[model samples]
Target chain A: MAIEKVEYWRWTESNWKNPDIPDWHGSLITAGVDIGSTSTQAVILADGVPYAYSNMRTGSNSPDSAISAINWAMKDTGLTLEDITYTIGTGYGRVNVPFSNKTVTEITCHAKGANYIYGPTVRTILDMGGQDCKAIHCDEKGTVTSFMMNDKCAAGTGRGMEVIANLLAVSVEDIGELSFKVDEEPAPVSSTCVIFAKSEATKLMRSGWTKEKVLAAYCHAMALRVVRLLERNGMELDFAITGGIAKNVGVTRRIENIMGIKALTPTMDTQIAGALGAALIAKELVEKKRAKEG
Target chain B: MIANYGYEDGSGHYYIKIDTSKCAECTAKGCISACPEKLFATELDDFDDEVVLIKEDARNTLQTNCARCKANGEKEPCRQACESDAISFSW
Candidate 1:
């Protein structure tokens, strides 16, 4: 009997709505949609306050992904499209959010979002998105001073880890905890390229290395790769990590260990940073418009 | 705003940062035609000012796409053609 294939790399999609905020009737409802390479997020804000959000895998097309993401965010929230006063689209497909009132770069959005999530003290932000990694320096107001991103290859990004997760047949959510099971830290993978690293990992596994040891090695390599980006961009104190990879203890712990700096623990879901920043921008635009009209 | 187009990776950084403020005053905009791959273009930026920028499709592939220019041992055509001194590169 043949067993069905299990796609362990796929993470569960999540949608959340704050129960405390009863209704958005009197508030200005603003929305933000981030269409990233591997995932999409929709965030809704009521009068510049956090509200509902959804995180889902991006489909082949972005417009559909944007719409579905928002729909999922509004599910059971008693919210409707008509309730939103404005929407800002951001990320890899910022231009393709069919209903966005405006578009902003992911770099700008992520910095602003981190400022809000981690508070005004946050100065450095490391965002490990699906296909890219960003190291950003921001001011107290969340304005970007300088930023660098690694998008040419998948070496240290979420996509790279996804490849490893599939190779190990381990659930993406469990990759972090499982990686720490090893008794001693293994040396990092020497190959800098994702494809080459995958092959190197396979070789190690074949040579009697356990899956956990390979994972530890890969995570160490990822941390080093991302640290190089931070060093290039200049890291400041009160550093924070965002995006999906921020949830992975394997990578985050390794990075903290190497840098000797503790990243801010997030109070909210880290994946929503871009969308939240977009929503924040939407609120600013609406305020500007209202002030101009008055 | 300075528009940085390109990415960094394990291999190294490859970027072309262009100052949009300077581009607004430029008339020739030679970077458009200077690149052998025609990687540069112009568009109304977020501030509604027409400025030069790298093509969206070429942003992520700058490493391989710009290899020939860097390997040729000549100043990059895009930066060399900029009369406004607005363009710079990270190799």
Candidate 2:
């Protein structure tokens, strides 16, 4: 018998290229690849404008994941790796990006990317990635003044959401909408820890609590954990959310309700912010090098 | 002004807060060489005041970098080097 494959927590892997700008001739092409713990995103920029990008699940090997992401992003775009003037690697696996010219911290990349994606007004950013959550404060130019991460816990991270999605037998993409189906918000679970939260969910299930209610409870707890991180780091106006969790309406809505501030909407996929920031930085680095050479 | 470095996580809080007001008065800047892990550095901050700060790259790796100090039962060499009470750690 073959091993059963689980698709519950599997979000779609995809690539996007701007159809409006099909040509990249004479443009300074740059690429940024963000190798996160759970997902990898590769973004290609042409003359400082986003040209192509890919978001995919990270593989077991970080280097290999980096390669796959860039290739997928450039698929049929007529751009090769050598065409890129510079490449910056970022995120949890930043050091493992074999083809990058430099590496940057996810904290810096997120702030820069948010400014671009959500506009220059974005001063506060909350990024809940695969295995960690970070809150960042940036200036008008996207310079990071301060930041903090939920470094030691999976409580407010995407990994915790995946586990719950798997246990609830709901597609991770659909779970957020399902969570709101509950008639009234259930009280948050007793524990913010993922392991303990899982056990609490099990107990709730045994007590005949609906899956939707349990999901609401869990998302509420997760949002609270995220709020604490943001408050500690200091939140500013024109806030935005990035990473996998940003796409989860359940978590984002709850966060807004608690903080009394609406998160800015991005025209592009929020998950690509880190990689986008890297690509933008790659462009900057190339210009700096050119100036030095002259 | 107090500048807090490092982070709080699931396990516990780990921070190295530097009182820049006190740091501004110190010309010796001894903390730069005191850390065994070379985690400290000096730079002119936003106010153009020279002060000791944790290396930017070193901030995220404090848990591992400070482990050696804890293992040897010599908790903080950097704090001891700061004669002006400018450096402190939250563990």
Candidate 3:
């Protein structure tokens, strides 16, 4: 069957507001904007607590995407750009956030965000983003101790999965479930490159291979690719995954099984880890300024 | 034969340039072990010589993966290890 021209991997945008946040009428408000290659996230914090957040697809302009994300986050909260005491930008477009007071690397931000969501015990973080993957080791306070990243290749990232979804005409969200329906776990694709894998998948399809089997092969390859990165950095306990791929059960399950350890479940949307961490940093910066002034 | 690794994105341009001529003369491939992120490997180039090159998976992420060294004002480990002065970063 010929695949239709559709963005099968485009996930829905979402926004959330923490109900427990007390009124921030006079309190410090901070925001973090993470403009990733494929998505943008904005997180608002009121006195260092998560107040509101928005996740959306990134558009052509990095600065514009950052602004749009933050605006969407602030929409229902009755907050505006002027209300923010500080702003920190992170992710691939950290330097492009025009309004940010500071910019933090996504590594540091992801560590801090994982600490907040998974608790301070999280020592290992694997963030599988749209175009890259990162294996980060952090201290109890979420300060990065060591880290490695894979961005030159697209084989083991969310983009890789999207390629497969487009090829198979399957929804990206359903690829995980469909991959498990195969009678047996197929051997992973031979190539570690996404381009080669796509060609290989095409050959398999032409040879009468089922879509489920092809998906299983691709997912397994992605899991193994990430496992190599994690092992190179020396995996520690209290591991967590923070990124779009964290929602993929197929890849996550295989990673857990291969490592013989379970990842800590995130309490919030995984994609917001970097932005949330940036917001937390913004709060700290604001408090530091206040103390200096006082 | 210069090899450039990295990509241009909305944020900025990040590239790691390797002078293959300098690399061709080097007998010891120290860069492969010098990088903590294991971003380097040896490959046979068109000249049929074993030269050190940045791994394909690390090209686009040079700035991020090298943050520690960059922030500390320390020379990049790979560049420091290359006695031939073959590796240079464009951040």
Find the 10 residues in a row with the least total lDDT in model 3 chain B: B1-10
Question: Model 1, range A102-170, lDDT digits (tens) per residue?
Answer: 998888899889999999999999999998998888899887766777777888989999999999888
Give candidates' CA RMSD values in order.
2.4, 4.6, 10.5
Model 2 ranges with Cα > 4 A deviation? A1-5, B1-14, B17-29, B32-77, B80-91
> What shift in Å separates residue A280 of candidate 3 from its native position after superposition?
0.5
Place model 2 in a CAPRI quality band.
incorrect
Candidate that beats the other on DockQ, 2 or 3, i.e. the better one: 2
Candidate lDDT (C-alpha), each: 0.89, 0.86, 0.85
**Candidate number with greatest lDDT:** 1
Compute DockQ for each candidate against the true complex. 0.39, 0.22, 0.08
Between candidates 2 and 3, the TM-score winner: 2
| Quality of model 1 by C-alpha lDDT | 0.89
Show how many residue pairs clash in every candidate, following the order shown. Answer: 0, 0, 0
Which ranges in model 3 have alpha carbons more than 4 Å from their true place? A1-5, B1-91
